[model samples]
Target: MTGPGQNPNGPGAGLPPVPSIPLTDETARDVAGEQSVGGLVKDVMTQVSTLLRAEIELAKIEVGAEVKKALRGSVFFILALTIVCFSLFFLFFAIAELLADLGLYRSASFGIVWVAMLVTAGLFGFLGYRKVRRLRAPERTIETIKDTAAALRHPGEHS
Candidate 1:
């Protein structure tokens, strides 16, 4: 059986009685009455400023990381482009020579390869332009900023 002044149905049935905190005027007023509206507003403004600063720092870190990744990728991409550009002359020259061997005039064979290369380049460039045109702004960051603004405007409401 639980002793008097002991909790009977908790995880510990005979737990010792906890000490009470004697409230002072400030604590009593904080617990039982409204704090001054000015104090409350100051506290909220301080917290919101801190939160916005943190958000800005997080965005900067995120953007910095992404920029580093893009820089690394672009370096490799440029290297590949340089190598391909140097190699294409040999490849197209071989094609032109093969065409000349197949009984076409040397000038005509070279001109045909030039025309074909131009058409292929134009096709790829158009496709890349369309793909880039479809790129959109950063949606997640925009959404988060919007949510923060809404929360700041209506502190009591939650999504």
Candidate 2:
């Protein structure tokens, strides 16, 4: 659901921001002993793990919300489309009658109208099929997740 120019990993993408869990500064100069450093590393690791889990949860929640909205919208869209299709019968009937009034055989006029409607439906269905075929995975979101993973792996390196 990232908008135009909005970073996939930005605040908007993960509305519920990560909790304020303080992570240890691994670069801190004050290191009393190796034991303390190990404890520090452990603490940092735990914090990072928690942060990663939280970020994942945020992603799941956001995606779920967007999916629910799409599902609901599609349901309404289908309902509207169904109604429109049914309503089109009257309009096409009027067109057929008009054709018949123009000196064409009544059966011929109705046949032509039916054929035209079928061709139009086929054209639209083909276009919809093409659109569906062109659907792709969310590359930006995948890239953002990769970047986050890289950042987490190399905490000392700044990108």
Candidate 3:
């Protein structure tokens, strides 16, 4: 008869006593090697694997946060750009009409207005490119990766 958690044929079963002996030198050496180097190596590998998994999870979270921030910023920038573009269009049309009324259409006034519009478009494009570069700079991502790798490499160094 055995208890619920006890296996009838296992060591927990009521059985005859067994003899014990002192460990021999070769047996002791084998056991020591398994407990020391082998066990240590297994533990280190497990820790590193866990650390890498945690870092990957953190990277996913950080990337998602960064992407959300970028998207929100882009939305606001697009809205502002739309308003500015419409305002510029209206202002340019008004100026062109004024030049026409002033008897400048047959002269270089129309060409100058077109050239100015082209320059304005190019300037806005350049500004947008600069803004995107600033927003998506790799510095933050690189820093995060470096910090995470360092933490994983020396987890015990923190505290």
Candidate 4:
């Protein structure tokens, strides 16, 4: 069903059609409400609550879809990491063999492998630290929230 201001012939046209109920005397009376301040406030609160619930449900659905996508992506990364681990194991062994063939002792060749692994680990650690340092709060969302608060505090003032 199309929402307020939405085009009826747009994408939402494919959705289930809203039921057509004839406005009989009984139905009209049921639809009408007491014309009082308290009634108006209660009606507004009910609408707001319903809108909030719909928004929360939409968020949950969107988040679930995103999490599913992330899980699928993680599977591919895990497979890649597994293959790379095995490839690195063989690569280090091959390098050690090459060093030994070049007249270095087997122990010395393996010692070089240990040093190389340590250096690689240190480089990764440093990169991770730098990435962590670059992390910051959501600046735009914070700014928008501040603006909303200001507008609410002074309804007549435009910020």
Best by TM-score: 2
Ranking, lDDT, top scorer first: 2, 1, 3, 4
State the lDDT at 39 in candidate 1. Answer: 85
Q: Write the per-residue lDDT of candidate 1 for residues 1-159, one digit (tens) a residue.
A: 876766688743533333222334667656787769898898777776766765665556556655655555455445545544754785667665664655666655665666666555555555545544544454544666788999879979978
Clashes of each: 0, 0, 0, 0
Task: Give the range of the ten consecutive residues with the poorest summed lDDT in model 2.
Answer: 131-140
Structure candidate 3, residue pairs in collision: none
* Local accuracy by lDDT, each model: 0.60, 0.62, 0.58, 0.55
Candidate 4 C-alpha lDDT tens digits along 14-61:
344333223446466666854588887887567556544544454454
Off by over 4 Å in 3: 1-36, 99-158
Error of 4 at 12 (Å): 9.4
What lDDT tens digits, residue by residue, belong to model 2 across residues 26-141? 55455543457688799778877776776676567666665655555455445545545864785667665664655666655665666676566555555545544544454445
Candidates' RMSD to native: 14.6, 6.8, 17.8, 9.3
Task: Give lDDT: candidate 2, residue 3.
Answer: 53
Question: What is the TM-score (0 to 1) of candidate 2?
Answer: 0.48
Poorly placed runs, candidate 1 (over 4 Å): 1-29, 88-140
Candidate 3 residue-wise lDDT, 6-122, digit = tens: 678983265322222234466777766676778778977776666566545555555665676667556545655665565566566656566454555523564465556656655
| Deviation (Å) of 101 in candidate 2 | 12
Candidate 3 accuracy as TM-score? 0.41
